[model samples]
Target: MATLSILNHDRKIFDKKYIYPVLSRRAGGLSLGINLNTNNACNWQCIYCEIPNLTRGKPESIDTKLLKEELFFWLHEITQNNFLSNHAPPDTLLKDIAFSGNGEPTAAKEFEEVINIVITAINEFKLNNLITIRLITNGSYMSDQSVQNAWSLINQTPKEVWFKIDSVDNDDIKMINQINPSLNATKKNIESCLDVSPTIIQTCVIKINGELPSKKSIDQYISFLKNYEKKLKGIHLYSLARPTEQKITTKIERLTEKELQSVADKISVLNLPISTYI
Candidate 1:
């Protein structure tokens, strides 16, 4: 007999379709998730990240062949079954294949190769242009030359990049991301990506020390966005949706749907296409 751990690293239950759960508030319906940092590695330790056993970043390689095979098998199951019906077959429906897991997918040295692998798998399933290949990234790797090149190469395949822009003030950003990259540099880097692909700024609003983002902080972030509204595809404003790993979890809370809508309304007043996800 083997000892059982509910959260075993190799105990993923989903197969043939990467990771399950096609419906999501953020990514929308049917998201085929790609977990690049299966080992739970990441550069930034966001207080809100949901991954357990989190570690630093990984420079290791992934089994691309196994990944492609798994993805195809999963898609085959969903398409062949009554995905959303009560008597639905044993397949999970998906809307898109999203590169979102424990860490930044772009941090993988073979990031470019993995993008090709996903594109090939999607085409094999005839999903081609119907489904999106979304990259949910922290935006830190965007400044790296090789990482940017990987994204550029990925442009050959149909996809979307959701860049995280949690805060505009340096101190606030440092508090959330724990990184010290210059805000001006990040804006320029994101602008660079816009030239190549449609980029959505994904922002998360949460409370700190029992308080929401200060009025000054929110104003600065909005002001920053106003300047790049023309260059951006849109804004994704979402609050916390999952339990956090920080010991101070009690200190944070998700903004109400109404509160989020208010923020969206302000952004709309700026003439920016802003969407709120609560």
Candidate 2:
């Protein structure tokens, strides 16, 4: 009776501690998700985040043994025990194993161990060419050597890190992502991730107050991306699909289809593959 919903990204839908499944719009089908941050904590408090009661912090200590057991169990269910047929829509393909919890997954101390577990699953299921291993991150700790080393372990399988880059203006960044981030540091992280993994730029665009992204902001965003046009895998531009639960001062609103298309038209000048989800 556990029907998966693409719009309802509630990680706790199945009562699982570390593993869950969702019909992901981005992944295009059943995305087996690994929720490392069960505590609803994150480094950046994005105003558009759908997670309720989100706090600012790193992930707590991971129970790797339990996590491994859950991962293997879910893999078995999907591959052999008819999980998709029973829990998700009929003929749902197992698209990817995404490390996309409520918080920044790279903050977990056992991130490398989890990657090792994924390697084992890949070999066990013989899914080398069938599915992808995705790390949906905010790109904060991508420069860490340990993180890079862990993520680089699975070379043969299809992999992608959907790094979030909402905006380039610091004021816009602060308003949307709630972080006084250093663009230089972000650049370094981007470089490190590119060196280790095939990366896609995941940007969530929302109307602030009552206006769409200004032309100046769009220009700055395009300018920053011009440097990575060759190195990046692609860009994902999407407006909010779910309502925000975070209590913030700014009045956030989902961009209309026209508004989103308008933004995409401006970014299309970069000539990179862009997919927009409303």
Candidate 3:
């Protein structure tokens, strides 16, 4: 078996279909990742994205049959054998089945159907009680009915949504995410998700062009969190952990551990639990 470590997450582990695994820092163990967007496409081209040749658009089509086959096969291996000990570090354990891949997974045409398929497989394999089902999304398509239906189903299980909220300032958002996303729309979408389930705010704070986000930018972000404090699970404050393939990589830099902690301190004022992954 190939050695799998959390330190290396750039390469696809399985190189097959939509299923793969990684030692997730946020998850604190081995995570089985479902990649619905095999085409390497995304609606937003985040400057710090690690996906190579990242382009604009949603996923074309998903082969649900193959996806089901791959997911069940891997689940059996992970549960029935010593797959974790053989590939990952000794302390690692299966944490969650995460929908996180090359792009926004909710953009897939079969988003709700895919979620149902995963849920069915989890039940079939009797892994529903053992692992959590998680969706790591940018929260772009959350307002869509299909996506909302999927979220409703996911809320029934031991699951969470890692909703990305890098910055609240529209200009900063455009600069970082490389798209013109409506601030109000994003907020509404987040609220919609929170209405059904608690969400973890995943923020990736980094230096762009050798400068940290301005005080105003940080203030706006804090205010945004303040509005949704009651509905949030916590904040996942992290910095860049992998090298990027985007052209803007030259302008991006990771924050130091101290800097990350300092930012966490600022957010701590909101009184939400924070997990820092610097």
Residues 1-278, model 3: lDDT tens digits: 57777787744656777898888888989888999888899998998999988889899799999989988888888888888778887878788999998999999989888889888988887776778899999998888887888778864469888999999898898889898868789888898888766689999999989998888988989988899888799999999988777986348899999999988888788868999997
Please provide TM-scores, in order, for all candidate models, with all chains considered together: 0.86, 0.98, 0.96
CA lDDT, every prediction? 0.71, 0.91, 0.86
| Model 3, runs deviating above 4 Å | none
| Cα RMSD, model 2 | 1.0
Q: Clashing residue pairs in candidate 3, if any?
A: none
TM-score of 1: 0.86
Which prediction has more favorable TM-score, 2 or 3?
A: 2
Q: Which 10 successive residues of model 2 have the least lDDT summed?
A: 1-10
What C-alpha RMSD separates each model from the true structure? 4.6, 1.0, 1.3
Kindly report which residue stretches of model 1 are placed more than 4 angstroms away from their true locations once superposed. Answer: 1-21, 82-93, 155-157
Error of 1 at 83 (Å): 4.4
How far is 92's C-alpha from truth in model 3 (Å)?
A: 2.1
Q: What's the best-to-worst order under lDDT? A: 2, 3, 1
